[model samples]
Target: MTASTSHRETTTADGRLSRYPVFLRVWASQSAGAVADQLLPVAFALYAVQRGAGAGTIAVILAGRAIALVVCLLAGGILADRVSRPRILFTADVLRAATVLGALLTLNRLPLAALGIVTALSGAAEAMSRPAMRSLIPALLPTGLLERGNALVAAVQRSATLIGALVGAAIVAAIGIRAAMGLASLLFATGAVAVLGVRDSVAGARTRTGVLADAAAGVKAIRRRPWVVAVMTAVAIQLFAGTAPTMTLLPLVATEQLGGELGYGLVLAALATGALPAIALASRWRPRRPGVVGMLALSSYAALPASLALALPLPVTAICFVIGGFAVELYFVYWLSALQRQIPAEVLGKTLALDQLSAFALLPLGYALAGPAIAAFGVQPTLLAAAGLTAAASVAALLVPGVATFSDPVGTKSDPAGG
Candidate 1:
C-alpha cells in the first residue's frame, strides 16, 4: 500500500486503540533503543577502566560519541526530509545493530581507541534515527492529539531512562562487557522491527535542492515564524546555560555533599521518578497557550538550586528534583506540540533536525565547564548561577512579542488529508 493510504486507514477516530497503537509502537521501539544507548556507555566505560585505560583515554572514548553527534546531525536531518522517515529510521537501526555487534565481538581484544571509533559510528546512527522519529509523529496522529502524543513520548523516554540505567548496570554485572553489548545489539534489532511496523503517509514531493540549501530553507522557515524562532532560542539558552548544570553537575554535588556515586544515582532517579506523574497527567491535558506554559514551566528551574543550597536531607532533595522534573516535562510537551503543528510536513525533518542541533550544540561545553566552575566556586553557588541563567532565559521568552500568545496552528487549519 502507498504510505498515504496506510496512514488514512490507521487514523480512524473510533478505533479501539484511539490513536494509541501508533504511540505504543513508536514508544516501544524508542524505549528499546534508549536502553541500548545507555547500556553501551556504562559497559564501555567499565571495559576501558578494566583495560587499565586512564581518565584521558576514557574521556576520549566518551567524547567520540559526542563528536559523531555534532558531525552527522545536519546530514541526518537532510536525509530524513528527503526520503521516507521510516526507511531512514530502519536503516539507522540496522547500522546501530551492526556497530553494537562489532563492539561485542571485539571487546576484549580491541584497544580503547578502536572501541571509541566503533562507538562513534553507533552515535552517528543514533543521530540519524532521532530526527526521523521526531518527524514521524505529526504524520501518525490527528492535530488535537499532538500534545498527548508528545507527552507519551516524553514519559516513555523518562521511564526508559530509569529502566535502562538499572538494566544496564545489571547486565554489566551479570555477564561480561561483551555479553552486555550483545544484549544491546538485540534491543536495537527489535527497535528496527517495531519501526518497520509503523504506518505513515508519504510526504508531498519535495523540491530538489543542495544539502546546504535544504538546511538553509529549514532555518529560514523558523526565522520567518516569530513564535518558532523565539521558542527555539529560549530553549537553546535554557538547556545550555541553566538546565545542563543541574543534570550534568548533580553527580558532582552528590559526591561533594552526600559522599559518592550512590548518592548521585539516587538523586537522578528521584528526578526521573518525579517526571512520571507529570507525563501521565499531561497526556490527557493540553495547554491552551503553549508558549506561555513553556515559559512558566522553565521558571520552575529557579527553585531547585535554591532549595538544594539549603542542605536539605535526601527526601527533601528528592522532592525538589521531582518538582523540577514535572515542570521540565510540562514545557517539553508544549514544545513538541508547537513544532508538530507549525512546521510544514515537507520540511519537518530538516526543521526538527535544526531544532535538535541548536538545542544540543552547546551541551558539550556545558558539561566541560561544570567541573571547573564547581571546583573554582562551590556546587551550591554554581547551581544557583545556573538557575539564575535559566530564569533569565525564561523571562526572555516571555518578552518575545507573540511567543506567549501562540496557539496550535494545526487546530484551525483544514486537514491536508481532507478527512
Candidate 2:
C-alpha cells in the first residue's frame, strides 16, 4: 500500500489521533521516555556532585554525552529507516534504563572515566530514539492530523522536560542522588513497556546500500530540495546566533541585573509557560503559507536577545522570553509538520536527522564563542549582533524558491491538506 493509504488505514475516520489506540500507546511511550531523558542528565549531574566531583569533571561527563549524541545521530537515522522503528524505540529505552542503572550502582565507586562512558551510552541511546520517534508518527496518524499530532507531541515533550528537571532536582535534594537515578531508570523501563504496545510499521522500502552510501543519500536528498536547505540553514542560524548568546548571557544578566537564581528561574518558567498556548494554537491553525508565516514567527525570537542586550527589567525581560518561547514552538510545529508531509517516506528519517544535525552541530561552537565574543566586544554589542543575524537569516530564507510556501512552486497547490 502507498504510505498515504497506510496512514489513513491506521487512523480513525474522524482523523482524531486520540481515538487511535496505537497512537495513544506511542504518545504514552514518548511522554515517559521524554521525562526519563530529562531526568537522567539532571540526576547524573547531582550524583557527580554528591560524589565530590568538581565543575570541570561534571562538565566533561556532560560533554561526553552531548558529543556522543552528535556523532551517533546519523547512524540512528540510518538504522531507523532500515529497522522497525518501534523496536528501535523499545531498544533505546531499554539501553537508557541500563545506563542509568549502571550509574546508580557505580556512580560513587567508579572513576570519572567510567561515569563518562555511562553518560555516553545514555546519549547514544537518546540519539537512536529521536529519529525513530518522529518517523513513527507518520505511520500512526493520517495526513490531515499530522500537524495536530505534532503539536501534541511537542506539548508533551516540553511539559515533560520542565517537570522532569524540577522533579529530578527535588528528588535528589530530598532523598539523595541514588534515589533520583533509580527513579529515572524506572521511568525508562516504563517507557520501554509502553512502546511495546505500539504496532510496528516499517518507515520505508528496504535499501541494500552500504552505510556510507546511505548517509550520502540523505545529503543528496537535501541538496535536491531547495526549501529543505533554506529552512535548515535558517534554523541553524537561529540556534547558533540567537539561542547560544541568549543562553550564555542570561545567567549573568540575572545575577547582575535581576535578583539572582530566582530571577533566572522565573524567566525560564515564563518562557516555557508561553509555549503552552502556542502549542494549543498550533493544533488548530493551518496557515496557507506555513513556511512564510513560520519564518516570520521565528524572527520574533529577536525580542529575547534584544531584551537582554538592553538589560530590560526582570518583568519585561521575562515577557520577551515568553514571546520568544511562543515563536519557537509555533514555528517548529509548522516546520516539522510540513516536513513530515513533504519529504518522501523512504528518506524521511534521514531528512529529519539532517534537519536536527544542522540545527545542533553549531550549538556547541556558538556556546563556546558567545562568552569570548561578549568578553571582547561587550555583551550589548554581541547580543545585538546575534539578534540582527537571526532576523536577517529568517528574512533571507524567504527568498529561496520553495521556502515561501514550503513546497515546490509547481505542485504545492495540489496538496489536499493545504500548507
Candidate 3:
C-alpha cells in the first residue's frame, strides 16, 4: 500500500517548530547527545579488542546494557508521567555522562565484570530518559502538529547518528578509544544543559492518580483500543524475528554468498539511505486510515529476509533492503503519530514505556535461538524462518478488530481513558 494521496498543514499559527527556541535548544542538545550515543558500540568494541578481550566479552557488555534497558523502561515511563519530564531527561543524560566518564577513566584498569556493570548502568540511565522524551511533545504542541514535530525529531536523530558514527570513527582513529568515550560524555553533558530550558510545564500537570493506578490505567487504555495491541504484537514479533538473525546470519551470508564486509556495509547503507526520505514523507502525508496503511507498510519488511534466503545477487538484495527500510519508517512514524493522537496525554508516558518493554523484552531469546537455528538448519533456512515469522506477525495484525478499519480523525479513540 502507498501513503495517502494528500498533504496536511505541518505547522500552526502561533509557532512553527523553529519559532520555539526552547524546542530548538532541546533539539540541538539531544542531537549532539545522540551522536555520542552512536559512538558507544565502537568505543566498547575498540576497547575490548585493544585490551585482548574477545567478541564474547564485548557481547556480555552489550547484553548487560540491553537487559537493563528492558528492565528499566517501565519505571522510567511511570516516573515521567508522575513528575517532570524535562527534569527526568536532564537527569538521565547527566547520569549517562557520568557513567561514560567513569568508564573512560577506568578503562584499562577496570575489571571486565566492572566494565559490564558500568555499561549496564549507562543503558539504564538512557532507558530512564526515553519515555519522557517520547511523551513530552504532546505538551509542547497542539495535536495538529505532532506529525511535523515527529518529523523534525526523526531528522535530527537519524542525521546525528549518521554523522556521529563517522565522527566516532575519526576520533578513534586519531586518539585512543578512551578519548572517544570522553567525547561521548561531553556530548551528553551538553544535552543535559540544553534540556534545562524546558520548564516543568512541558509535561502536563501531574494528575492526582496514584502511580500504580496510573500504570494500570495505561494498560487499560491500551486494552480499550484492541488495535494498539495488534500493532505492538506485530512490531515485537517482527523485531524478534529480524534483529538476531540479521545480526548473526547476514554477515555470514555476505561472506559466503556475497562480497563480504563491503557487501554487508553497502546493504546497511542502503537501508539507512532509504529511511532518510521518511522524515519528509511523514511530515505531510495524511492517510485516511493510518492504522491500516501502517500495517501494510510494515508487512513489506518481510521481503528483505526472504530475498536473502533466495541467495539473490548483492544488488537485488540491497534493493529489497531499501524497500524494507522505506516501508519500516512509514510504519514507525505513522504508528507513533497515531498513538500520540489517540492515547491520552496523562497516560502517554506509561503507555510508551509499556510499548518499549513489550517490543524489546524478547530480543535476548532471538539472539539465543539464532545461532542454534543456523547450526541445525543452515543459513538459508534460518533466514527463511525469520522472514516467515515476520510475515505471519504482520499479517496477524490485520485480524484484530480495528487495525484495518480505523479511520483518520479518530475522535473517540483519542480519549479511551474516558477522562
Tell me the TM-score of each prediction against the true structure.
0.81, 0.84, 0.84
- The TM-score measured for candidate 2 stands at 0.84
Better of 1 and 2 by lDDT: 2
Give Cα-based local distance difference scores for all models: 0.69, 0.77, 0.72
Model 1 TM: 0.81
lDDT score of residue 342 within candidate 1: 57
Question: What is the alpha-carbon RMSD of candidate 3 to the true structure?
Answer: 5.1
**Cα-based lDDT at residue 157, candidate 2:** 81
Model 3 lDDT at residue 282? 75
lDDT of 2 by residue, 1-419 (tens): 34553564455447577676787788888788788776666656655555666444555555556566678888888887788888898999999998888778876687864666777788889889888888878777777888788998999887776667667766765787778778888989999998885656654556566887778777877777778899899988988898878765665576678775446556765676677788899899888888888899889889989999998999999899888878889888888887787666667777788788787777656766776787799889999999999889998999998887887677433222211
Candidate number with the higher lDDT (1 or 3): 3
Candidate 2: residue 35 lDDT (0-100): 81
TM-score attained by model 3: 0.84
Write model 3 residue lDDT over 172-277, tens digit each, in one string. 6567777788889998998898888677563454667777787788888787777888878888888778765765455456656777444655665566556668
Better of 1 and 3 by TM-score: 3
